[model samples]
Target chain A: MDRINVCIIGSGNWATTIARNVGRNVANSQHMEPIVYMYVYEEIVDGRKLTEIINTTHINVKYMPDFVLPTNIVAVDDVVKTARDADILIFAIPPTFVNSCCKTLLGKVKPTAHAVSLIKGFERGDDGQIVLISQIIMRQLKIPCSVLVGCNLAHEIANDNFVEGTIGCRDQKYFRLLQDIFKSATFRVVVTDDADCVEICSTLRNVIAFGAGCADGMELNENTKAGIIRRGFLETLQFVDVFYPGCRMATFFEACGISDLVTSCYANRNRKLAEAFVKTGQPLSELEHILIPGHEPLGPVTAELVHIMLEKKGLADKFPLFTVIYKICVGDQPLTRLVETLRFAREDM
Target chain B: MDRINVCIIGSGNWATTIARNVGRNVANSQHMEPIVYMYVYEEIVDGRKLTEIINTTHINVKYMPDFVLPTNIVAVDDVVKTARDADILIFAIPPTFVNSCCKTLLGKVKPTAHAVSLIKGFERGDDGQIVLISQIIMRQLKIPCSVLVGCNLAHEIANDNFVEGTIGCRDQKYFRLLQDIFKSATFRVVVTDDADCVEICSTLRNVIAFGAGCADGMELNENTKAGIIRRGFLETLQFVDVFYPGCRMATFFEACGISDLVTSCYANRNRKLAEAFVKTGQPLSELEHILIPGHEPLGPVTAELVHIMLEKKGLADKFPLFTVIYKICVGDQPLTRLVETLRFAREDM
Candidate 1:
C-alpha cells in the first residue's frame, strides 16, 4: 500500500497537539509519511516568522508553549502549498478562519484525501440554516469530511493524559484509518457514522456550559447545578431530534455528546465567562473582553444563531433554555432570573 | 376519589427529606392525607425514643440535624402499625433491614397500596440472581413497586435546593401519584416505565462511583477520570442489556442513570472512601470505620455481590471494570493498576 501523506491545517494549540500525535505515529509507522506539514498562516513572532520558529524550536510559543512538538512536523505558511498532495487533511483552525483557508485550497487538495474537522463552532448559511464545519469543508473541497470531537483539552492531551475522542465518519475505511492515526496509549478514539451529530454536539455544548456557569455564579447547590446541566442536556437532545432528524439518540451518549458537555460545563472558558456574566451583571461582550481578551465567547454567538434557526423553524417555544440563554446573553433578561426561567422551561418538559 | 394515606417506612436522612416533600405536598392538597407517618426503629437518643424525639423536635437529630422536618410528618415505631392502612409506602431503609421490616409488615400493609423503593443497594437471591429491592418489595407485600432515584444529595434536597429525581414505574397511575407527592418548586420528578433499569442503575452506580474514587485516589487526570466514568457507563449499559433484556437504552440517559452516576462520582461518601483507600493504602473496611463510622460503603459490597453473580453466570469477563474494582477493593489487585486495567477493558469494547 502507498504511504498516506498527512497535513494539519492550523497552528493553534489544538493543531500543534494533533500534529504531535500524527507526527509521532507516522514516524513509527511504515504506512504513513514521516513528515507532517502544518499550515501556519504566516505570522511574525518576535523578529522571526511563526512557522520558522515552530520548525526551529518545536514549540508553539503563542498558544501551547510548554510542550515540545515532534521533530518531523514541518510548518508551512501557504495553505495551498501545505495541503497540496496530502492524503489526510486535519482541520483544527478557528471557525472564522476555515472559509478563507478552504478558499485557498479549493481544488488543490488531492481528490482522494479524507478530511477530519476539529473546529468547535458552526456557521449560519444564507438560508439561515446552521452549517457544520465539516459540511463547509466538504462543500468547498468536494471530499468526504468527518468530525473529531470530545472533551479534549489541548493541554491535557499534550501532557499525555488519558483522553477519548469520537470520530464521526460514514466510511468504515476512513474510520479505521483515522482511528489508527489518532489513537495512542493515552488518546483513544471511538468512531460512529453520525458526523453531523458529532459536529452539532461540539458546537452546542458551549451554550450548555454557559448555563452551568450561570448556575455556579448564582451560588446554587450541586443538585441545582446538576439539574441545570441535565436540563441543558435534554434540551440539546430535543433540539437535535427536531433539527437533525436522522441523528440517533444514542449518539448523545458518546464522547462527542454527553462527555464533552460534562467537561465543558465543569471546566471551560465559556462556563467561566457566563459565570462572570452572572456575578458582575455585565453583558457577555464585556465579560469576554475581561475574561478572554480578543476571543469571542462562542456560547452566546451560537445561542443567537440557534435562536434564529429555532425561530425560523417555529421551535423557539420548544427550546426554552436555549431561548433564555440567548436572552440573558443579549441583556434582554437578567441573569438573576435564570432559575425561574429554567423552572418555567422544565414545566414545558 | 379516596384520599391516599402516605407512610414513609424509614426515618433516615433521605427518608426525612422524602417525608418533608410528601408532608408539604399533602398538607397543601385535599386529595391525600395531611399527616405522614414515618416508621422509625425504636432507638433511645438522650433518654427518649427516637420517634418521640422526632415528633417533638421535628428533627432526625441523629441522621440529619441541619434541617427541620415538616410539622405534619409524625414518627411511628411499630412497622406493622406504621404501614397498616397506608395507600403509598415509601421504603427508604437499607437492604439488610428490608427483609426483617417486610416480614413484620407482610400481612399488615394495605393491599391496594403502591410502593416506591428509595433503597440504594441490591439483594442477591439464594440462586445467585441479582434481586432488585423493588422486586423484593413486590414479592413480600404483593404490591406494585416503583423506584425514585437521581442525583439527589439529601442535605441539598432538605435545604430546598432545586433537584430532579426519576420515578421508574410501570403503572401510570402510580407514576402520576408519586410525582404529585414528590414534586415541588425545588424538587422535580420525571417518570419512566422502566423500574428495573432505575433500580439497577442506582445500585450499580455505587460501583462506578468507587471506580471514580479509585481514579481520584490514583491521582489520574480529569480526562482519565471522565474516561473511566464513560466506560463505566457503557459497561453498565452492557450489563443491563445482558441481565435485564427489556430495559430501554434511553433509560440510561435519565436522572436515575447518568445524573445519579455523575453526582455520586463527584460528591458521595463511597467515592470519598474509595479515594481514601487508594491514598492511604488501607482496605475499605478500615477506611469505613474511620470515615463513615458504622456505615458500610455500599459500593464494595454491591461490587462483591455483582462479582459473585457475574461469576455464577460465567459473565465476569464481560465486565472488567466492575471486576477490577471489586478486586482492587478486596486487595486482590493494587489500586495503581487501575489505568492499565481500564485500558485492557476497553480493548474488548
Candidate 2:
C-alpha cells in the first residue's frame, strides 16, 4: 500500500468537525499521510485571520469554538495549495459554493486523485434543473466522485456521540480506502453502490422535513404527522424513480435515506423555521431574518429548485408535498393545504 | 358483484376504532352488505352488558366510549356466530387471543371466505418461535389472509384524523375487495405483494422501537437516537432476510415499516415506559403497575420472544440492539449498557 494524502475543501460547522475525525483517523492508520490539509476561506475573527487562528490553536474558533481539531489538520488559506498534492479530496462546502471551489482546483489536482462529497443540498444547473454537488465536482475535476450523507449533527459528532453515515461509492475499488478514512469507533459507515440514489435523497429530504414542520405548527396528532411524512417519502420515491431511472429502490433504506430523512423531520432547522413560518403567520423571508438572520434553511431552497424541474416536466401535481411546501414558502398557498393535498392524492398508490 | 359480509372479531381499543372505519366503508361500498357484525366478549359495564350497550348506542362504552360506531355494526357475543356468515372476516384481537378466536371460527366460517388481520404483535408458536398473527389466522381458518398495519393510534383515527395504512395482500384477486372494505377518505391504504415481509415488520418493529425507547430513556442526543433506530431497522432487515427470504427491500420503506417505527418510538407506550424505567430506576413490572395497571407495552413483549429465536440461531451478537433491549427488559443487563453496546457492536458493519 502507498501513502494517501487527504485534503478537506471547506471550513463551515460540519467541515470542522469532520476534519477532526479525518485528521485523527489518518494519523493512526498505516500507509496514510498524517497531515490533512483543510482549505479555510480567508476570514478575520476577533482581530486575527481564521486560518492563522486555526493553525496555532488547532480549533475552529469562529465556527465550532468548543471542538478542538487534531494537530495534524493544517489549515491553508489557498484552495489550490491545500488540494494540490492530495490523493483524496473531500468536498464539504455548501452546495451553493461547490461550483466555484471546483473551478479553483480543476487543473491543479492530480489526475489520479478521487473525490468524495459531503454536501447535503442541490445546486441549480445551467438548464434550470437541480444537480448533485458530487456531479459538479466530478464534471469539473474530471475524476470519479462518491458521496457521504447521514443523520450527522456536527456538534454531536464533534462531541464523540455515535453517528451513522452512508458512503455511496459506485466503484468497489474505492470502498476500503474510503471506509478507512471515514469509519471510527463512534462514526459508523456503510457503503452502497447506489450513488445517485443516495445523493438525491440528501437533497429531497429537506422538503419533506419542511412539510413535517407545518404539521407540527398546526399541532396535529402523531398519526396524522406520520401519515403526512409517509406520503412525502413515497413522493420522494416516485421522484427519484422517475428522474434517476437506474437508481436502486433498496438504497432508500440506507443511512443516507430514511435515517437522514427521519432525523431531519424531527430536529432539522427547516422544521423549526417552517413551524415558526406557519404559527407566526410570517413569510419565510421574515422568519429567516428574525430567527436565523442571513441564514436560510435548505428545505425551502431545495423545494423551490425542485419545483422548477417538476413543473418543467409537467408533473407538479404528482408531487404534492414538495409543491405545497414550495407554495407555502412563497406565500402562494396556505400551509393547511398540506394535509388535504396528501389525503386527496392517490391513496391506492 | 355479490354482497360481501364483513366481520370484526374483537372490541378492544384499536379494534373498536377500526370497527368504526370498517362499518362506514362497508356501508358506502357497492355490492358490500350494509350490515357489519363485530364480536364482543360479553362484559358488564355500569351494570349493562357490553354487547347490548354497543347494539343500543352504537358505541363500545367500555373500550372506546368516545368513538361513535356506525349503526350498521351490530355487536354479537358469540365469535362463531359473528364470522359464520361473513365473506371477509377481519381479525382485530390481540396476538395472545388470536389462537382461541381462530379455533372458535375454524369450522363455522364460510368455505370460500378470506380474512384480513389488523394484529400488530407476534405470538409464541408451538415450536418456541415467534409466529405472525396473520399466519395463524390463515392456517387455522383455511383461508388466505392479508394484513393492515401502520402508524395508527386508536383515538387519532377514531377522531376522523388522517391516517395511512399498508395492506400486505399477496393476492391481486383480493385487492379490490380488501381495498373496498378498508379504504376511506381519512383512512388511506396502499397494497404490497410482499405479504410475509409486511407481517414480520409489524412484529420486528416492536423490538426496534424498544431499542429506541431505551435510547430515549437515556436522553441521548437526537442524532444518536436516530442512529440507534437506523441500526435497529437494519437488524430488522437482516432478521427478515435471514429468517424469511424473498422479501423485497423496498417494502421496508412503506408505512408498515419506517412510518410505524418512528411513530411508535416517538409516542407509543413502549417509549414512554422505557423512559420511566430509566428515569425512576424502577423495574418495568413496577412501572407498568404504577402507570397503566395490567397493560404491557408491545416493545418488550416482542423483544423477549424475538430474542429467544435469535439466540437459538446463534446470531445474538449480530442483532445487538434487540439483544440489549431484551436483556435490559428482563433485568439480565442494566439499561446503561444500551449506549455502550451499540457503540462497540460494529462500526464497519
Candidate 3:
C-alpha cells in the first residue's frame, strides 16, 4: 500500500491536533509502510508577541510527546509552496479566513488531492446556504472535495485526551483511507459518504454549542439540558431536511451529535465565551471578538439560524430551545424567560 | 361532554399531589367536570393514622371528598357500594401493594371506568416486566384501562408549578376524554396512544431520577447529569423496545420521557434524599429502611436497575455511561468519574 501522505494547512489548534494524532500513528508503526507528512502554515505575528495576552499552544514535533504538540512533523511555510506536494490536504483555518486562504492555495495544491474541510458556518445571502469549509475552498479553487468533521479537536490535542469524531467524504476511497489513517485508541473516527448529513452535523454542532452554552450559563438542570439537546437535534434535522435532503441523519442513533451539542454548549470555549457575554450583558461586539469568528459573527449566525427556523421553516413552535437560544444571544430575552419557555414547551410536548 | 369522575387510590405524597392538582383544576373550573374522588387504602397501614393524613389533606379540599372504610372497599365489597359510578380509577399505591389493591378494587369500581396509574417500578422475577400500576389492576380485575404519568407529582402539585407529563391509552376517545379532563394551562399534559411508551417513560423516569439522586448525593455536575439523562434515554429506548416492541418510539420525543427524566434526575426530593445518603456514605439498606418503605422505593429500584444494566445486560462497554453510573450507585466510583465518563462518551460520540 502506498503510504498516505496527509498534509494539514494552518497552525491552528484543530490543525495541530489532527497532525499530531495522525503523525504519531504513522511513526509508531513497526513497519513504517506509509509515511505521513504534516505541513503547518503558521502566520507571522509581529514579534511572536500574540501569546502575551491570549496564550500560544506549542506544537510537538516529537510526535506523540508526553507534554505538548504530539506529532512528528515536517512543518512548512506559505500555503502555496507547502500544499503543492500532498495526497490529502486538510483546511482547518478559521471560517473568517476561508475565502482568502482558498484563493492562495487552490492551484498550488495537487489537483487530484483529496481536499478535506473542517470549517463551519452559513454564508450570508437571501437564500442563506450552509457552507462547509471544504466547499468554500473547492468553490474558490474550482475543484471537487470532501469534508471530515465532528467533535474531537482542541481538547484532544491540548489536553492529550481521548475523543471520537466523524469523517465525511463523497469518495469511498478517501473516506476509508482517512478513517484508517486517523483511527486510534484515543482518537476514534467514523466514516460516512453522506456529505449533506456530515456537513449539517458539522455545522450545527457548533451552532447548537452556542445554545448549550446558554443552557450552561443559566445553570439549568439535566432535564432542561436534555430537552435542549434533543430539540437542537430536531432543529438541525428540520433545517437540513428543508434545505438539503437525502443526507443520512447522522445523529438518529449516534451519540456524537447530541452529546457533542451538550459539550459544546457547556464546555466549549467558544460557546462559553458567548454564554459569558450573554450572562454579563456585555456588548455583542466584544463577545464576537472573543469567539472563533465563524463566518461573519457567531452570535448573528446563531440568531439568523433561529430566525430562519421561525420565519422560513415555521418551526419556532416546535423548537422553543432554538428560539430561546436566539433570544438569549441577541439579549432580547432573559435566561429565566428562556427556561420558562422551555418549561412551557415541555408541558406542551 | 359528560364530566369525568376521577377516583385516586393511595394517600402518599405522590397520590396526594395528583389529588391536589386535580382538585385545583376542578375548583378553578367554570363548570364541575372531571370531579376527583380520592381513596386512601389503609388495610396495610393502621386505620387511625391513615385517616389523620386524609383529614389533613381535606382541610383545603375545595371539592367533595369520599372516604371508604378499609374492609368494605375490598373486591368482596358491593361493586357499586363504594365507587359504583366513578369514571377514572387511579392506582397510586406503592408497587408492592398494587397487586393486592387491584384485587380489592376489582369489580368494586365501575366496569367501564378508565384507569390512570401513578405508580413507578417494575415487578422483578421471571417475567422481569414493568408491572404498570394500571396493568396490575387490569390483569387482576380483567379490565381495560388507560394511564397518565411522567413528571413527579410533588413537583407538579406541591411546588405549585407546571410539570410536563403524558396521558396514554390505546383508544383515541378515552385519550381525548382524559385530555379534556386534565387540560390546564399550568398542568400541561400531552396525550399519546402509546401505552407502552408512557409506561416505560414513567417508570424509567423514576429509575433515572433515583440515579440523579445518586449523582446529586455525591455532588455531580450538569455534564454528568446531562450524560445520565442521555444514557437514560438510550437505556429507556432499549428496555422499552425489548419489552414492548410495538410501542411508538416517537414517545421518546416527548417531554414525558426527556423532560420528565430531567426533573426526576435534578429536582425530585427522593433523589435529593438519596444524594444526602450518598454524600454521607450511608449503606443502601439503611438508607432504604429509613426513607423508602412507604413509597414505591424508586431510589432502590433505580439502584437495582443500574445493577441489572451493568451486571446482567453487559452493556457497560457499549454504553459506558451506564457503567459509570453503576459505580456511582454502588460506592465504587466517584461522582467525578461519572461526569468524566459522560464527557468522554459524548466526545466519543
Candidate order by TM-score, decreasing, is: 1, 2, 3
Backbone clash count for every predicted candidate, in the order shown: 0, 0, 10
DockQ top scorer: 2
Tell me the tens digit of each residue's lDDT in model 2 across B233-264.
77888889878999987787777887787888
In the predicted model 1, the residue pairs found to clash are none
lDDT by residue (tens digit), candidate 1, A1-349:
7899999999887888877888889999889988889998787889899888999999988778888889999999888888897999999898888898888888888999989898878777887778899999999989999999994587878888778788999898787789888877878788899878888988888988888898888888777666667777888888888888899866877788777877887787899998888888886767798898846688888888899999998888888888888888888887766677655565334
**Best-first order by DockQ:** 2, 1, 3
Model 1, range B1-349, lDDT digits (tens) per residue?
7788999999887888888889999998889988889999889998998988899999888888777889999999988888998999999998888888888888788888888899877787887667898998999889998989994488888777777788999997776788899888877788999889988988898898899998888777777777777778888998888889999876776778777888887888889999998898876777899997746688898888889888988988888888988898888887766777655565344
Model 2 chain B: worst 10 consecutive residues (lDDT sum) = B340-349
Best candidate, TM-score: 1
**DockQ of each model vs. true complex:** 0.52, 0.55, 0.23
Off by over 4 Å in 2: A1-3, A347-349, B292-294, B333-349
Q: Write the per-residue lDDT of candidate 3 for residues B97-167, one digit (tens) a residue.
A: 76666666677776777677777665664434335666666777666667777656453335434445678
Fnat per model, in the order shown:
0.45, 0.69, 0.19
Point out the higher-scoring one by DockQ: 1 or 3. Answer: 1
For candidate 3, write residues A1-349 as lDDT tens digits: 5555667676555666676666676676653333444444443455443222112344343222344544345556556765776777777767777788777876777777777776555454446534556666678876666766655335443453435566767777666567665666545566667775776665666666666566666664454455565566666776667666776643443434544554565566556765676577786677666664543445447556656745676666666766766776667877666557645664333
User: Of the candidates numbered 2 and 3, which has the greater TM-score value?
Assistant: 2
User: Between which residue pairs do clashes occur in model 3?
Assistant: A3-A34, A60-A69, A63-A71, A63-A72, A64-A70, A212-A265, A213-A265, A223-B262, A256-B349, B217-B275
